[model samples]
Target: MKKFIIAPSVLSANYMNLKNDLTQCLENDINWIHYDVMDYDFVPNLTFGSKILQDITSQIKMNIDIHFMVKVKTKNFTDFFVEYIKANPQMMTMHIESMNAKETKLFIDLCKKNNIKASLAVSPQTPIKKIIKYLPIIDNILVMTVEPGFGGQSFIEHAAGKIGLLRKIIDQNNYKTTIEVDGGINSETSKIVKDYGVDIIVAGSYLFGQKDFAQRAKKLAGGN
Candidate 1:
């Protein structure tokens, strides 16, 4: 069986004091720092950019998952990808929406050359078939329960159905791509999602905003 990874999202962390919040994840041995990169145009809200990622990447030992939420842009993303991969290779994923199908495939190919773990993300409103086209090229699949720009949004219950669909497809095709679910992954929901074939669950508010961040992180990591 594949491991169930708990990548805590920074979207729910207190922006005023990110270091301390990130420290919580490190202290608990959470392996991946799931960062959400959003542009104001793509998702209606903007998030901290590459500079912050550069700073944080230097401090953390765990592999980072840079989930780019912006619509795929080929030229603009080239240098950013080059730089981020230079800082920490083999763990970033640019969103499929950021580029067209051909461009997305090319982006994943670029990541392969640079040793980055490329991934594709899809919004709830977007049809699942759009993501299916790039399934063979990308390393992971991020199924967004809520809209991707900001945190605090509730997980769409129907999102679980997509997991079942992808799981079946993967099974039938013998695909190795990991299935990841982001947004509202608390202890209760994590169990529910895991049962539905969600291999990686990104928990932000569920971990960072808690009083016992360490314990919560452990519970999530242990899939309790």
Candidate 2:
């Protein structure tokens, strides 16, 4: 099994004091930062682009995990995929709901060629079977606990079952793919997510809303 990790989402961070928040998270021993890349076509909201990602990466030593929610057009995705991989990120994820199986495999191959871990992301309504075939090659599986558009949403309880099933498939095949759960993750919901076999927890509002960022990060990581 992979080591547990708590990734604080930058989408919820105070943009005016972004570096300070990231520093505080690191002070708490939290080394993974989750970036949500949204293109208005795939998701209703628009968020960080390469400029913002570049800016953040330039200042931080922590591992970066990008969640891409954009149009599934092959050419466009390939271009964006190349750009994100150039950042030499720890992981880059694409929505299984957005692309066809062939595109998903191609994206994974591209990431591998660039030495970046490729992850498959699924929305709450997407069936687990849609992503199972890619699990053997993917480094991670991002199970969205809420819709992909925005942050500060409630946890969709059924997402737990989806994660459990994916875990079973990974275990049965003896694959090393890590299961990551995102959206609506706070202290209490994270506990439920752990019970469902999530290896990485992505928390946005729950983490950034608090004043004690370090302590909040520690608690989310299951520390004392």
Candidate 3:
């Protein structure tokens, strides 16, 4: 069987006891945590900055999957993420819609310089062709099943077709790039994406909203 990772998104985590929640994840054997960074300008909603990310990384031993939903400009890529880079996440993902080709390459190079895995994210409406050229170079690809800004939305059924196409391309090219899907990833949707070749599953409300986090996470991992 292929390896499947369940990365619980911190967006739906309990802020009052954030560390405790994260510790529970680690105890449950789920090591990767999906951290979403949203700038109000890029996604209409505002999320945490590098300082908070640094705080989380400093305390938790879990791998941080930083998804930057903010806009990236060529002039300010480094400046905007200097502190985030210091946090030293396991992987950093940026949206293809946020940057031009030059900026995208610059972001990937920046990740390489810092020894962080670079990944590109595509929104539900954006076609796979937009980032086809990047599949070989990037470490992973994030396919957002719902809109990027908020959580708790239903999974878009049409995104499955996109996942299938991406899987076909990756298999044909023999690329090592992994596919990650976010939003509305409950037991049912998890199975759908897993069949379509998703290696990583990002669950927000579905995981955090439940009392038994480990059980839900195991189900998302394709357990019976």
Every model: Cα RMSD to truth: 2.0, 1.9, 1.3
Model 2 lDDT per residue over 1-224, tens place: 33579888889999999988899888888899999999899999999887777777887898999999988655555776666665668999989878876777778988888888889899999888887777888899999999998889999999768888887888999999999999898878887888888899999998885877666676777732
Better of 2 and 3 by TM-score: 3
- Output the lDDT of residue 14, model 2: 92
Stretches of candidate 3 exceeding 4 Å from the true structure: 73-75
Collision pairs in model 3: none
**TM-score of every model versus the real structure:** 0.90, 0.94, 0.96
Please, what are the lDDT tens digits per residue for candidate 1 over residues 95-147? 65667766676778778888788788877777788888677767888888887
Rank ordering of all candidates by TM-score, starting from the highest: 3, 2, 1
lDDT of 3 at 62: 81
Candidate 1: residue 184 Cα off by (Å): 1.6
Q: Could you tell me which 10 consecutive residues in candidate 1 have the lowest summed lDDT? A: 71-80
Clashing pairs in 2: none
**Using lDDT as the measure, which candidate wins?**
3
Computed on alpha carbons, the lDDT of every model, listed in order, comes to 0.78, 0.85, 0.89
Report the lDDT of model 2 for residue 109.
Answer: 86
lDDT of 1 at 134: 71
